[model samples]
Target chain A: MIKLQLPLTEADVRQLKVGDEVALSGIMVTGRDEAHTWLINDKPDNVRKLLEGSVIYHCGPVVSKTDGEWKFVAAGPTTSIREEPIQADVVKEYKLRGVIGKGGMGPKTLAGLKEFGAVYLHAIGGAATLLAKSVKKVTDVIKLEEFGVPEAMWILEVEDFPAVVTMDSHGNSLHTKIKADSDKIAKELIGN
Target chain B: MAFKLNKEKFRDAVLELIRLTSTELPRDVIAAMEKARDNEEPGSAAKSVLGSMLKNVVMAKADSTPICQDTGTNIHFVTIPEGISLRKVEQAIIEATQQATAEAYLRPNAVDSLTGKNTGDNTGVMAPYIHFEEWDDPAIKLQLALKGGGCENVSTQYKLPDTSLKAGRNLEGVYKCIIDAINKAQGLGCAPGVIGVGVGGDRATGMIMAKKQLFRKMGDSNPVQQLDDLEQKLLVDLNKLGIGPLGFGGKTTVLGVKIGAVHRLPASFFVSIAYMCWADRHHEMLFTESEVSYD
Candidate 1:
């Protein structure tokens, strides 16, 4: 597994392949539907600056407070396909180096990744508690009051956050391959 | 003498049920996952994902945290004795869900479909959706399932005898539809998955009954002989598709298959599937006048 740190360089992201496993460290931001919609509609300068050269995770975490400090109880990836409508634009506009999500994105996002030198990292879905262990601290939360908990942007400091690169800057997409392969297998099996 | 329900007791019961089901992967589900893990080739992505899922269950339980971040939509299936108050149960469930959300057993997941607004409390119109049934037994039974959005998105319904697939209106047709659905899902539904199938009924109830099939234990066979045979056969066939965990190619794509049938009009033959992720969290509670017990 390759290890990555925050503020990933274009060269760093470009080196990834479709099946490379990665363990990310440093700062990252969590966002989902509302955040995506907000980014596309307004493109806030401060948020863009914060996200510059950083990984964006498609996640809605279950967080709790203890001793007056917020902590993650569970944090896992939501489906990334929902962001396909805006991800390509966001990646290009923000100059993001990496996108971490689950289930992969569509063609538009793939094109954006190739154009902007970004990679789509696939986090394991449904493994929330295990994923939470990688988050070192909750640094800040943005748009909480506006988007509510799940859709809020959670800026986190993480160490060794694990994921796999399913879509890379080189135009390789594991999702596309798996979908076609599985379809062929299904057809063949059903024929018998 | 008429039995009276205590609102506080019911609310507490609901809250506890939510907490337990959210944090703890049911034993049956764990067993199936472990079997899938064992079945996969060593060092494969599918095996690694299953290993991670098993570890996730342990960590979630040990820390008293939610198994999946989504915590999903809370579906409550309520069976009450005649003369009991549905309003009281509904109120208690709503209250329990709010409390659970605050305590972090559930995420704030209920959104306004039209407005795209998050209710923030996990309760909105038709949220914590309830389905009612009347039973002769004196005890009130409530079954809760936490369904994550990814699997929910992949769940599909089919009107069979699909000519494109050469599927006829029979068990063979149902089998084709299920394979087609799984093929379309391709690890997107967080396979190895649990398939809950409703063989007949109108659209809504068909889906509901299909979801209800998820409550069955992983290895339990359908009571009906034909359905049982189909369930077994489909379980084998789906796992052979090689979708694996999270769509990473390997063996052990589907963990279980459950099928239930409901009465339908002659003109309609709908098969509804509720594709449940590996985090198949569900539990049941029985409330009597004096006490509440969980299964």
Candidate 2:
């Protein structure tokens, strides 16, 4: 397993292959549909300053506040395919080095990853509480009121946040390959 | 005669159900996950993935944190005693859902489709969706299922004889639909998954019934013998696809298969699948005039 720190270099992303298990450290940003739309439409300065060469985690975290500090109750990845509509543009525009999500993105996002030398990391979906442990602190939260809890872009300082590279910078996607393999076996089993 | 509801007690009951269901994985689901974990080759991604998932379940239960961040859409199927005001029950659930969201037992999930606005509280138009039916019995039964969006996105509905797969309109066709849906889901639906299938009914009811099937305990057989047999058979067939946990590929692709049938019009044959991720969060509560019990 590879251990990567955020603000990853293009060379760092290029070295990753599809199916490489990795643990990410340093600062990362969280976003979903609302934030994606906001990014593409507005290209906010705060986001560009924070997102350059960093990973964008597709997560809407469960958060609780205590004494004015926000703590993660549970934090897990949301489905990535929903972000496909704007992800390619977000990648190119943000100069993103890695995209962290589950369920994988579509062809457009994969092409964007290859073109921009980024990889799509698959976090374990439904492993929210476990994932929360890796989050060192909730450094900041962006657009909390506008996008709500799950859709808000949260800036997190993380340590050893685990994920697997399912879409690599080389234009390879484990998600696509898995689908094809499963489909072939399904056809044979069903005699189609 | 109608049984009067104690507003505070009912609200507490719903709140407790939400907290327990959100924080804990039911025992049967835990067992299935454990078995899947044990069946994998040591040090494989599937094994380690299932290991972390099982660990997450344990930590969530111990810490009283939500099992998954999404905490998902709260779907309630309620069977109330005759003459009870369902409107009151609905309001109580909605209120309890709000309380739960504030308390962080649930993530606020209800969103406005057109505006992309989240309700902030998990209660909005059609949020914490409740389906109510009156029963002759004296007790109220409530079943809640928390379906995460990742798995929900991959769920499929088919019009049989799916010509693309060459599946005809029969039990065999239903089998084909199940396998095909799993194949398409791959790791996307957060496999090892629980598949609840509804055969018959129109599109809407088919989906509702399919989701209802998930309320059945993980290993419980369908009351109908044929459906029971099909459920068991499909479980075996799906695991053969080798989709494995988190789609990394290994043994044990599916955790459970549940099938239900609804009466349908002669014109349409719809097969709907409610694909549940390994989280598989659900619980049931029974309430009477004096006491409330949960399982």
In every candidate, what fraction of the native interface contacts is reproduced? 0.77, 0.80
Per residue, candidate 2 scores C-alpha lDDT tens digits across A133-166 of 9999999998898778887889999999999998
Q: Write the per-residue lDDT of candidate 2 for residues B134-193, one digit (tens) a residue.
A: 788778889999999889989989998789878888999999899889988888888999
Per-model tally of clashing residue pairs = 1, 0
User: What would the per-residue lDDT of candidate 1 be over residues B135-253, giving only the tens digit for each residue?
Assistant: 88888899999999999999999997688888887989899999999989887788888999998899998999899999999878788999999999988888878778998788888
lDDT for each residue of candidate 1 in A74-173, tens digit (9 for 90 to 100): 9999998999999988888887898888888899999999999999998889999999999999999999888888899999999999998999999999
Q: Tell me the spans in candidate 2 whose CA falls farther than 4 Å from its real position.
A: none
Q: Can you tell me which runs of candidate 1 are displaced by over 4 Å?
A: A66-68
Pairs of residues at least 3 apart in sequence or in different chains that clash in candidate 1: B187-B247
